[model samples]
Target chain A: MTHNPTIVVGIKQVPDDDEVRIDPDTGRLDRSSAPAVLNSPDRNALEAALGVRDDVGGQVIAMTMGPPPAADVLKEAVAMGCDDGVLISDIAFGGSDTWPTSLTLARTAEYLDADIVVCGEETTDSSTGQVPPGIAAHRGWAQLTYVEELEPLPEANQLAARRDVEGGYERVVADLPVVVAVAFGENEPRPAGLHRKIYAENEFEPVTVDANDLDIDEETVGLEASPTNVGGMETIEGVDRERTVVDDVDELAEAIRSTEVFA
Target chain B: MTDIDPSEYSDVWVFVEDHDGDVMSVSWELLNEAKTLVEETGEELVALVIGEDVDGVVEEAIARGADRVLVADDGVFEPYRADPYGEQFRAMVEERKPSIVLIGGTHTGRDFAGRVAVPTHAGLTADCTEIDVAEDGVLQARRPAFGGNVLATIICEEHRPQMATIRPGVFEAAPPENDRDGEIERVDVVVEEADTLTEVLERSTGETADVTEADRIVAAGGGIDGDLEPIRRLADALGAEIAASRHAVDEGWVDGSRQIGQTGKTVRPELYVAVGISGAVQHLEGMNDSEVVVAINNDPNAPIFDHADYGIVGDLFEVCPELADALEGAEQPEVTL
Candidate 1:
């Protein structure tokens, strides 16, 4: 029998990008202004993990690290066909930057005995694309980032992925226990089934782990442990355009030509 | 690891990314920017080049204003497997202890820097659009966050080697100084094949050009209705690159690399022409920096018109072909006295 790799896919609840706004006075993101939803790419990551599980017989677990409200994403993951969900949440994990956040997730993955960890290419809110590789680095595991496709070589105990590069794509094969960062929009996430949605909404409760549960040093898992600090923030001022209304395509083309763009 | 004294670190190091034996322009751009930081900090400007047979890259780094160049020329780093490259970089950080490390925010650089920063406990800022040195020799990395709505300046106050990944094309590359001299040192490659868990099996180049580097871009949106021929013709007439909004990319009308938005690549082209795009806030966030924007949409109420310098209300199918013809006619030789 082929080895069933235990896969843990990381998901996050992020503010809807279209609605996200920054407070002009404080230069800080106004989280309350936007409604929270499952990050789009994380949905793809979960879909990727589910696809892997369906191909080979294995358990697909959804994992997330955020505040209490982050559990919604986990329940949503369960509704989408994950076997179980794990939420690493605590007040201490709040204000944690990518470094500590990644460390905590790495420890949680270890605790879960995950053979594969999948993450979105980046969270829409931060768009850092740091956590996936950071998790791998913390645990000394291989990573395949910006992956668009994945094939499980169950017999070889490895996963092969097609990942995006600057101007092209490359195919890579990694040993088990690798972190895969799924590219955004690469796959169509399946809709929640009626039965699964009903069960998830009423009966599903994700396993919650805190800093203490993961044995993470308190000093290394919060804002105090984060190395990068926001020195300041400023809103980008929108430029006032000429807003010249042109009559026809010829006039528009003439206006474009008048600009020094081609020069 | 965080206990290291900040005073112990010295010099500004820029990682020179090598792509298929050629050094990426972003590397030299970083070296140029690092020159100013080194002058303020009273430290040397160093370039870190890691790849197979990187002698040519080393020479370019020195010519581009590197006071010293560190090389890890080995086959193990040929295709940039994260494990070996990260290990080698982490080992160097522990030994040499540079004050600041700047890497190009490319796919390879982002992957390598994120992995190395965790083990080294370095503070890494991503996709920095601007970088400067403070009076105390601290590196101030400023980057856009919250979908380019706000720019955040980040700093590593206590960290020894402050690190940042700079977006390409944000800075200019300095002119080469052929007579410039610099010291070259070899980095000890401690990573072996056994240490690498990932192996690159194959690579295939795509046809789409990098829109981020283009001076002029004609981008289509969902209103194009899955047809790119009109967009391509307009781009060809204008001598511009073809790009698309996230909507068009999701519809499979264009390659993902050609996408521009909050989730896609941020671009600051000289001239941006939006065709049939409604200009969602996310899409505008990516191209708002363009010097001039021209929007063509059937709806005058399209939000894209708010950000555009010029707006034309029409069907893209009609406007595109006409505009292409008009631009082509305008390209004819002018009568001169």
Candidate 2:
């Protein structure tokens, strides 16, 4: 409806996979032990949002909800040329499943009056990939999932997307005010911009929205409102097969021919 | 947890994906799986088929394992959309309350699952590898996270109809027995266009190879150089579908449609050849069910060897060209899904 599109990207900070350790007692990630880093896929969401803004003028708002340390990712997003950043943080928002998580995000989208909300396909910690669609359903908006590439047509208030589906690729379109789930590696995330970084450090202070800031229904804004619970957790590993490497190409070829897989 | 009684729910239900009378294989697989969950919980097995002319799906579900089949045949259900499809389940869930609902983890099914979860306040788990009944009668849904590094077991402790979209290939479809007796109920469903937000512009889905259904797959990973011609040639020679690990997909060496890993498709092909694959736990999780696996890598200690039945430690640049030459004009086996 405006001259410039309003793109909102929901980013998250997750435990670095390599440095993560599972707490055997609680069967949950030891976040304190593992340093927090941006959820890798969120880069694509930011990239998609920035790309749209670049093609047609727009404001990119990067948002996240976590502890104070999570502010680093919003800074990184700002460094990457987002027009602004917002962090939704509070102790009451911890331990949220997709339900409450989306409630918080949906309210933020409303608070920002975002025309489009972009999200990573899944988070490394939960890997549920439900929050995006949950937000769309709660907001009564269109949703596109696993979108590899998307472009907003400003005049028509429509967005066309290339979606990766079960058996093949599909071209779909949704009206504005839709939620899009961008898969990892959709586009190369641009390196942090020099001007944006200067702005992030000197002139920019991220707007923090807590429970008191928005019209959050207390009954549906915290972990207490989530429908799912972690009953238990266990580590799963692949079975190890014995190794016998062939020395030469000829031997490898011979082995391949005789192998049951080929037969 | 809420004070809701577990007795309020009565059966284990599955969403049967019936597109113009053609039932997707995964729905049948889920029906078979729901049979197992029903046994553990001592509940009835039911199947929900929504679409016009889906009588074949309903009958087949009854034959396979469903004690009851709810069929919603309406013209509005012709095109599958999340909002309408979600409402069909939400209305039924409100009336007939099933303890658990299983769906195939397809893009359409998962999006629909998410919408339904909100309306019914059901806890939804996507891409679940396994599911069962807990000792306390709660649904135990387990899924791999962080590239298969850990398994998280989740439960809908406060919700009804603990829902999960099970990975398609985890369970085999049960053989249908026409003689099996079952009950069928016809549902009345109506939808307003305003209730749905989006429509598919152009659907080009049937052409691409669904790696999950490919009997033989040749997968490439990060160890492979930018050149994928060699791997493509090898796959062509063997009449196998091409699959890629996350690394290969991320590197643009292959398409993500065929990626095999925790974040991609879970495959159970009969023969899998991993060329230049280091076998990240994520990659291994997708194809560990293959009947046989052959690994070709230069690194002797590459993690792929741990899951491969045959290991060949050699430079793929040399081995691939040589292997291509050796197998040149060789007979390509005929495989079927």
Candidate 3:
């Protein structure tokens, strides 16, 4: 039997869309006001990993990093068929950008000895596609970004993953001990099994780790060490819409035809 | 006004992106831009070419805009691999003490810029849309952030050499300054074969779309649903290339390479026609610099109209075909690539 490589997926709990509110004063996303939920793309990533687990018969683990409230995303990941879940939650992790976040995750991933590490291309709130690349940098691991599909290559201890390129997909055969930044549509995230959901909800009591646990220098993982910093933010005011209602498709067609914009 | 002393830094360097014998277009673009900056500041525009046949590449750099091209050619530098490239770049910067290092925001550029910036302890602004010297003589690099909704100007005050990745197509290529003369200085690129960490062994370049050379673009957004045959038809009608937002590509209605946004290509077509796109900040950042923008979406409140020269709020399926038909009669414009 082929060796079933261990897989690990990282998830983030974000504010559900309904609860996502803009801070009128700052125009930044109001994380405090929004109710936290599992990151949707991360769920898709978990599904991709689980699909690999099912096909190849391997162990799948999920990990998360956030404040105390981030444990909820771990439970949700476990409920989605992951055999185990780990949460790295601490106050020190607050205000961390992609660099430190990836550093912490790299430490956790190294601890897990995972052959494959999967994560969403970006977080719902930050939305900067930096974590996967940064993690690869921290661990010196090969990164297969914008992964749309994955096929197992057991013989080479590698997987053939397709990354979305400018005009076509770049099929890369990445050796194991790799990090993948998965985008949506690679697979439709499977619904959490009833028994797994029940088990995850009741049995999950998340384990947290602090700065002391990981052997890392503090300057590299926080706002101070971040390469990019948010200068400031302003709320986007809703545009004043001048509605030109067309009663029929002809009027719309005529308007589009007459427009000299593209001309 | 805190004026940066020119004497503080010694040289002006352009990061040359070349593989095998062919130099990337962005390298020439950066040299052209860097030449302008150096000329304006009365500094020498130097090229740091690291690869095989360094002399020929350096001559090419001087032909484009470099005042002096530094050549560090060897077998290890044959391909623009990340580790050696970063090490070489950082070493040159430390040795020569360049005021600013400009890199093209290509795949290899990003890889080298990310690693070199960290080790060199220099500030790096990625995918910068604009680069300028402030009145104080500080290098000001402007880039879109928060999904291109807002533009931020970054500066490196503490660091010696200011670094930035200039996005392709952001600047136009100017003719070479033939009157100016430059020199090529070859250096030792002495890394043993055993020291090489990663081998290119083989590389398969993706089929070229040449979307950047397209005069016109038909970009689809979240508004378009179902089959994309209609969009393709419109693209065919205008001889325009097809592009998409992240949403459309994520839907699997289109390939990822056609994606235009933060994580995708930055296009500056002569005419950009957006179909069913809501004009998200991410999408807008990629195409806002287009010469002309026409938006077609059913939602009147779509954000795309803010930068659009003309907007038609309606079903794209209905309006797209009509637009295609209308363009058939209208004289097609020429795009200077």
- Maximum-DockQ candidate: 1
Error of 3 at B210 (Å): 4.2
| Candidate 1 C-alpha lDDT tens digits along A46-136 | 9899999889978999999888788999889999999999999888887888999999999999999999999998998888899999999
Q: Provide the lowest-lDDT 10-residue window in model 2 chain B.
A: B328-337
> iRMS for model 2?
2.8
TM-score of chain A for each candidate? 0.94, 0.89, 0.89
Superposed Cα deviation of residue B94, candidate 3 (Å): 5.7
Task: For model 2 chain A, give the 10-residue run with minimal summed lDDT.
Answer: A237-246
Q: Which window of 10 residues has the lowest lDDT sum in candidate 3 chain B? A: B195-204
Chain A, candidate 1, TM-score of: 0.94
Any residue pairs clashing in model 3, and if so which?
Answer: A27-A235, A165-B257, A166-B257, A167-B257
Query: Per-candidate DockQ versus the true complex?
Result: 0.69, 0.58, 0.20
Interface root-mean-square deviation for each candidate?
A: 2.1, 2.8, 5.2
TM-score of chain B of 2: 0.86
Which tens-of-lDDT digit does each residue in B1-337 have in candidate 3?
1233445785568888876666667788888887668766778888888888766677778888888888888877865555566567667776777888888876556656655664455556677877887555568887765445456776666455777788776676556655667887876664565643344433445544545557789988877885687688778777789989988978878766567776566788777888888887767777866766777888888777776766777778877786677656555555564
| Candidate 1 displacement at residue A9 in angstroms | 1.0
* Cα TM-score per model: 0.95, 0.91, 0.81
Q: Which stretches of candidate 2 lie over 4 Å from their true place?
A: A21-33, A254-263, B1-4, B18-22, B208-210, B213-215, B223-227, B236-239, B250-257, B299-301, B324-337
